[model samples]
Target: MITRRDFMKFVGGGFASAMALGGYAFAFEPLARLNVTRYALTPPGWTPGLKLRVVALADIHACEPWVSASRIASICRQANDLGGDITVLLGDYATGMNFVTRYIHSSEWSKALAILQAPLGVHAVMGNHDWWEDKTAQRNGGGTTFAHRALSDVGINVYSNRAIRLEKDGRGFWLAGLEDQRALIAGKKWKRKHIQGLDDLDGTLAQVGDSDPVILLAHEPDIFPRVPTRVALTLSGHTHGGQVRFLGHSPMVPSRFGDRYAYGHVIEDDRTLIISGGLGCSIGPIRFGVPPEIVVVDLG
Candidate 1:
């Protein structure tokens, strides 16, 4: 029979081992793992000999202890190597926090992302975090203006509730990039005045002809439900795959729709919604189960 003291010692050792493993999973694993997720999107009426490869990256919180300018550069190169016809960057380039945040200038992050290019072109949309000013860093007026200028300088077509037409191999489609829904409507400051210049889905669609295929780029997937059935696909990122997951299901999905629109592709009502897991961390800069990723969606 085992002695009582020996049993206690064994239990103590087991607990310590578990703590060490948990720390590694929460801290070290997240920093090193980067996944390239691929999806072949065949939207009912497949256009022959016409294909659109779009590489989507989002939530690149370029800050210390997590993402650096060098890491951002490497990510851009990785995205370029994917051979996408169009590259869409969903925003949140800067971290949103008042403590322990080592933020980089939006321009520097843009310089790294400048390496990304495609035949159709590169497009981007802003996120809610991008609109909040960095108090700790003393950055003025958020970072939207800087980010827009930086991305524009790098040849990226930054769209705010706008649609751009793209053609590939004699096939054409309209790509709409929508601004952050919450940023436009939410916030205590906006309470006094009506939210102007909101991202209107119908307004965006008005620019394109009815017969052409349409793809929407919205930062938050919560808007996915409001998207019309006519749209073939909607790409979004913001949840960051809940930062942690258990049993293949993330327990902390941050959306009004919860896990219903959490991450990955969901086909409902003749439309496809794809929410990227994203390429960086948020809050504590710790991720488990869900690693950084670049989403590659091929639409044909």
Candidate 2:
């Protein structure tokens, strides 16, 4: 029942709308917008009378005009205002995109992270971009990277396949940080086409040596499938909510499972995974419906 002329008009209107949306995505959203996304949940088998307020900041792809040390410090201040019992830096502290006017050095940004104040302390894990940008680590296939050292230099506890126990109001729980999954990219030891990561989930969990509920800090959400129920919650931030989501559906997600782990809290088989939308951009200088966010998770 549609005529050719009517179809043409409809097509023209759709084209105009697309262009307008593209313009907004490229011009305004990535740089001008920020959000605070909060989640409150009690995981299955969570310890009784134990309450934890966690502030998670990730994918900070710091660069000039998009994310700078000053901006990072401001964000830390904002996060401090939230009064998180513990603050976790999920990953991607290095610059990932080339569209930036200038790259913010790891030293500067790590210093900004030192402003974060939490009772349990500030903990960090390096992401794929943090490893990818470190030429020395990629060349040697294994060693200390600049990102790790820089964070340590600034007094941030950088976790590398390690776990530690912390107490909140006399209740004890284990916090574990896994090594990045996409750490070694260009090493000759890598024969397969897929990424060669250095994460040791079982080994890291083995170090717990305690019966307290565990909270795992991983940079990428892909590990959620392999994580056992012993961990009360797993937090990650690498997909950036597809960076251009619309109507809760992202057309292009970095994860193999697509939108499954793109963003937000997901409970699968009684295990919980909270993937933060993250704080910065990568690949390109555009952001759409999924704005830059600081995720707050209240877990018990």
Candidate 3:
């Protein structure tokens, strides 16, 4: 028992709802929301009498209107207020979208990030965009990318297959950062399939000279499965919560494993990985369901 007028009304309501959702995804969520997500965990074999607070920012994709220097500075201030023992920049300071009003220079974004402070100082790792955007680096296939230079020039310690031992209040832990796994857009030959990478997890972990628990920083969570249990934690970004998530599931994740490492806390075979939803857009200026977030980890 359906009337034509009632059916028309139903269709109109559906159309309006669609438009509203589109507006929110395209405009509001990407530009308006910023959340602080915290995790407190005592990883297996964590050092006793040692506590560390880590504040991390990832996938800035800095650009006009979408992710501005002002916004970055504000994010820095807020992150500093969280009182982290160390602050880490998880990368992708370059613009991710093709459609943008104007591009923000690398120096501008890095300068904004320079304000982030911590007792252990600010450390950084380059993301895929950081490597891909540097035309010269890609052409050479082995040179310092602009993103690395930008972060380094600003006094941030950028790691590449390196590990450093950091001490807090008398206890110690090793902090390691792996080079981006997809540094080369043009994949290199690896048997039948082409592969992209600069990451060296085994070599990096080898640099650890002690039995101290390790906290690894990698730009993409794809390396999670390979991470050893000896490392207490791994922090990563790059998926941006698949850019559009719904009901805790992302249909289109950029990782090879799909939603397996799309976002948030992940534990596999006793190893731990924490992936940030990230603070900016990628591919397009849009976000739905998954809003931008800063991650804080308190480890003991």
Candidate 4:
């Protein structure tokens, strides 16, 4: 019973409502809600009474109009205030996407992340973005060195297929840092042989004790399955919580593992993997259901 004019008005109103909702998703929610989630995990070698807090901050794509250097520093301060025993940075320091990619220096991000404090130490591992120049540029291999130097210069031990032993309050365990798997694959494809050290997981784990509980630091969650059973937990970030989630599932997860291990805690038999939603954006600076975050894991 509606006239053509009335129908057009209804259509226009629906379009306007949709645009408003899109604006909130693209602009409001991404910047407003920064979440910090706490998880309680008991690894095999963890002492009964001692609680070790490990804070992880990932994907700090320090770019303009979305993530600034000041914001990075603020994020570090927040993580430090959490009183963590150790802090791990999962990398993506430079901004992504060809749209207005600001060449925010690696040192700028390191200076911000160095503000983080932990009793044990602050460690970092490179992300795929760190190995590549930009979303579209040809891979030349200098980005990895630049990224590592920046963090190392600031005293954040950047690891590539490396393991370190830590003794805290009479309890000792091992931590292994693995390089970004995508970078490894790309290197192999391009016949680049210099970066083989980063992908050597077996060599890195060879130093750990057989019975000691180990925590592995991997930037991408896709590496979770390859981790051995000796490793009690693996910390990762790269999917960005699918960057957008609808009805508790993300349609565009970048993993071959698909939605099975997109975000949050996932248990596969005896091994537990915790994937951070990460703090920045790639492709586009828009996050819908997923908010930027830092993850705090307490090992009891």
In order, the Cα lDDT scores of the candidates are 0.79, 0.91, 0.91, 0.81
Q: How well is each residue in 146-194 modelled by candidate 2, as lDDT tens digits?
A: 9999889988899999999999989899999999988888544234355
Ranking by TM-score: 3, 2, 4, 1
Question: Pairs clashing in candidate 4?
Answer: none
- Give the per-residue lDDT of model 3 (tens digit) for 110-178: 999999999999999999888888889988996689899999999999999999999999999999999
RMSD of each: 3.7, 2.8, 2.1, 3.5
Better of 2 and 3 by TM-score: 3
* Top candidate (TM-score): 3
| C-alpha RMSD in Å of predicted model 1 compared with the true structure | 3.7
Decreasing lDDT order of the candidates? 3, 2, 4, 1
Q: Identify the runs in model 1 with alpha carbons over 4 angstroms from their true place.
A: 1-3, 98-101, 134-144, 184-197
Compute the lDDT of residue 1 as modeled in candidate 2: 92
- Give lDDT tens digits, candidate 4, residues 110-142: 888889888899999988777664433234532
Q: Could you give me the TM-score of model 2 versus the true structure?
A: 0.92
In Å, residue 257's CA in model 1 sits off its true spot by 1.1
Best by the lDDT measure: 3
Model 2 spans with C-alpha error above 4 angstroms: 1-19, 187-194
